[model samples]
Target: MESPIYLDNNATTPLAAEVVDAMAEAMRAGYANPASQHEAGRRARRVVEAARERIVELLGGQTGGRQPDRLIFTSGGTEANNLAMFGLARMAEDRYDGPHHLIASPVEHPSVARAADALACENWQVDHLEVDAQGVVELASLENLITDRTRLVTTMWGNNETGVLQPVAPLASLAASRGAMLHTDAVQAVGKIDVHFGNSQASSLAFTAHKFHGPLGIGGLLVRGDTQLAPQLFGGFQQAGLRPGTESVVLVAGLRTALELWHTERSARLQHLTSLRDRFEQQICAELPCAQVVAAGAERLPHTSNIAFRGVDRQALFLALDMAEVACSTGSACASGSSEPSGVLLAMGCSDEVVRGSLRFSFGAQTTPPEVAEAARRISKACKHLERQKHR
Candidate 1:
């Protein structure tokens, strides 16, 4: 059997061998419940603390001072995002008076945007910030949207679909000046870019392990020590009562190992992926003159490229690539099953035709030059076939 090329790392990555080994070892011997008082429990607690330390270090957070000890591990990126949005929104309600509002970019993952919508249903005002054609947040419009009633301003550090990196630092600073807490969903940004909780003004950030070559079903919300976010779950005092449940020592250990590896080799890995992405795009453009690279000049992540082919159905191209043994995506994996155009593209001022014709290809550590070249070849061929079929 031939090795299938994977260009969908933004959707999820294969678990690293180191991560699997660490997880297996943890499951074999670190089975004690961390909440118990026995020696085994102490051992489990130590492992959890050590994993937390590694994660904090990877995120470049200070170990001491008013640093964040409020790391709440959740099911995944979606849950972490929900916890950050709902938890902070509730806290704002309890602490402040009058109508509470939230400001978020329209290009945000549905986890954050949908949670804000749910909050809005409960009478909270939710204002969605629009992104420009380049997929960056319109910073000028942000100042006008932030008013006294705005409790939180939630935006993604990197868009999952277009891989467009937002001006999070400036947005965070703006939120802080307006007396509003800022939360950024950094799920796509954590391993691909440098994230510093100690230095960043964002009150909270969310990340998932799978995005970083770690095991799935594990992620966390990084809440600043001074942030007054309320717990969304009600139960035991696990994760300082912010996220309650029996901790998955195996998953946590795997995540820490993955994070450690990423921290050590981030620069080299980024350069490699960037080269692969650029090469892929160049080949695509050379082969298909009608293709348009979405947000071509924007500051996108090193691994991602979203391209639009004129008069070609993205779904057809997606399945064609899959059948050709090259795995890619139509847009965000979360919305892959849907036939509708990508909200991210639509929000970035892309025409309906562009939205319907877009495909997202993301690279990762396991991706190779040959794989990218082959994938681009397959895509060009598929586009030709699609065009011929349309003409028929």
Candidate 2:
């Protein structure tokens, strides 16, 4: 059996060897609960704290004249995002004396979108900022949506599906000017792009290790020291009770290693992924003239490409590609196994036909030129075959 060409790095990345080693070593040497007071527990606590410092440094959270940000470890990006959205909203409700209004971009991940919807159901005014045709958030609409009642503006730093970079800094600045706190779902952007939480101006940001070649089941939410999140889980004194749980020293160690690798090799890895992505797009376009590159005019992540194969069924294309031993996705993995069209493309004003036929291909640091060539060939073949079957 041949190895499948994995092009779905946006969903998750294969663990780096160094990260795996770090996690394994931590598991062997530090198995005590980090909350305990014994020697073994102290070792575990040290591992967790060291990991936090590494991630803080990676995000530029430690700077002059300001205390280092607080990083609350969670199960993954979903939990981190939920803690940011719901936690921040709850904090706003406690401190303020008006209607609690929260805003999010239309193309946000399900975690943020659904959290906003939940808040709306609870009598909180929730607004979804509109986006332009390129999937970029409309600045004017954002400004128009902000009112005296708005307390939080939650936006994603980078879109998971289309890979289009959001104008988070300006958005954060706007929210700050309006006395609204800003939070960003930086899950897909943290390691793939240059993400400086200090400069982002967001009160809180979320990221997962799996998105950057670390272990699963571990991620962090970095909150500015001045920002407060009402405790979501309460049982222990861990993470200041915001996310109280037994810290997983092994996973945290892996996450730290992953961040270190990304911080060290970001430039070279970005260049490699960009070359693969560009070549893949050029070759695929040549193979299928009717295919449209989603958000072609927008600044996008170097590793991601979302393309629409006109007049072809996306599910059928996906199936055909799978048969060719190539792995990709129609959109966000959170929306996988659903028959619905991509919400991201729909939010971009793409026609139903285009949305139905779009697919996301994301490369990673380990993806090579040969893999890119093969993926393009397999995708072209699958699209052509699927188009013929559709006509038949």
Candidate 3:
């Protein structure tokens, strides 16, 4: 049997060969607790510190200030986002006089949205900033929403489902002007796009290794110089007590290797993925003339394309594609198993018909033109078959 074309890279990517090898070596050699004061522990501590410095270098070095920034490793992007969102909000609670406020875009990942909800329950004013038809948030409205009490503004750098790039930089500047801290969830943007901590004014940013061909269960939140982040986890002196835990030396090694590869080959990878995405979109659009590419007018990730096929049930079409050995998704991987349409699309004012019919196809660094062409062929055939059955 032929291998299936894997196009659902937006959900997660397969680990790179170099990343796996580095992880194996770290597991064998640096297998002691980093906090231990003995020789073996000191060696492990050195490995952990080296990994942290490599990550900082990947994020464009510590150019924001004289002091080096802080990167706290967590279970993954979810924990990193929670630490940035919940941790900062709690810090604001301790500093401010009366009811503090938080802001987030409507199309944020569940991690950010749910964290905002938790803050709202504590009597904090949480506003879901509005987005336009292309899923880009309204900047003018965001300015109007800011008040003196607004403590932090949380937004994702790139949308997970639509792949639309948000106005994170301008938002950060706006938040800074209002004396409010900014935090961006850059999980989907870090390795796939040009995300640099030095260039951004955000007080904190989060990312995960698994999103970029590294090991899962390892991610970090970069806290800018002197950012006040209250401890999210409690136990020992790890990560300044911000995210206390015995660091995974092997996972950190994998992350460092993956990031180094991405940093060095970013330009070539972007061009390659962009070409594949354009060709794939052209093929699918030619085969299905009635289909609409979500956020086509907006700047999107080079590897991601969300297509909405009118008059087709996405669940049925997805199953058909799966049977044909094609892989795709209806929305965010974290929101899988839900019968409901995407809130992101609904927020963009898409009708129920369009919302239920959309599917995400994301490419990877290793995806080839032949694989994309074959996947498009299979998808076109499956969609045609589904449409005929519905007409019958």
List the candidate 3 regions with Cα displacement exceeding 4 Å.
Answer: 61-66
Q: Estimate, for each residue in 158-252, the C-alpha lDDT of model 3 and write its tens digit.
A: 89999999888899999999989999999999899889887888899999999899989999999887788999778899978888889989988
Residue 226 lDDT, candidate 1, scale 0-100: 84
Q: What is the TM-score of each candidate against the true structure?
A: 0.97, 0.97, 0.98
Q: Residue 16: error of model 2 in Å?
A: 0.5
Taking all chains together, the TM-score of candidate 2 against the true structure is: 0.97
Candidate 1: residue 376 Cα off by (Å): 0.6
For candidate 3, give the lDDT of residue 10.
83
Residue lDDT tens for model 2, 136-185: 99888889999988999988998999889999889999999999999999
| Residue pairs clashing, model 1 | none
Q: Deviation in angstroms for 323 in model 3?
A: 1.3
Q: How many residue pairs clash in each candidate?
A: 0, 0, 0
Q: For residues 172-212, could you state the per-residue lDDT of candidate 1 as single tens digits?
A: 99999989999999999898878887677888889999998
Query: Poorest 10 consecutive residues of model 2 by lDDT?
Result: 60-69
Alpha-carbon lDDT, every model: 0.88, 0.89, 0.89
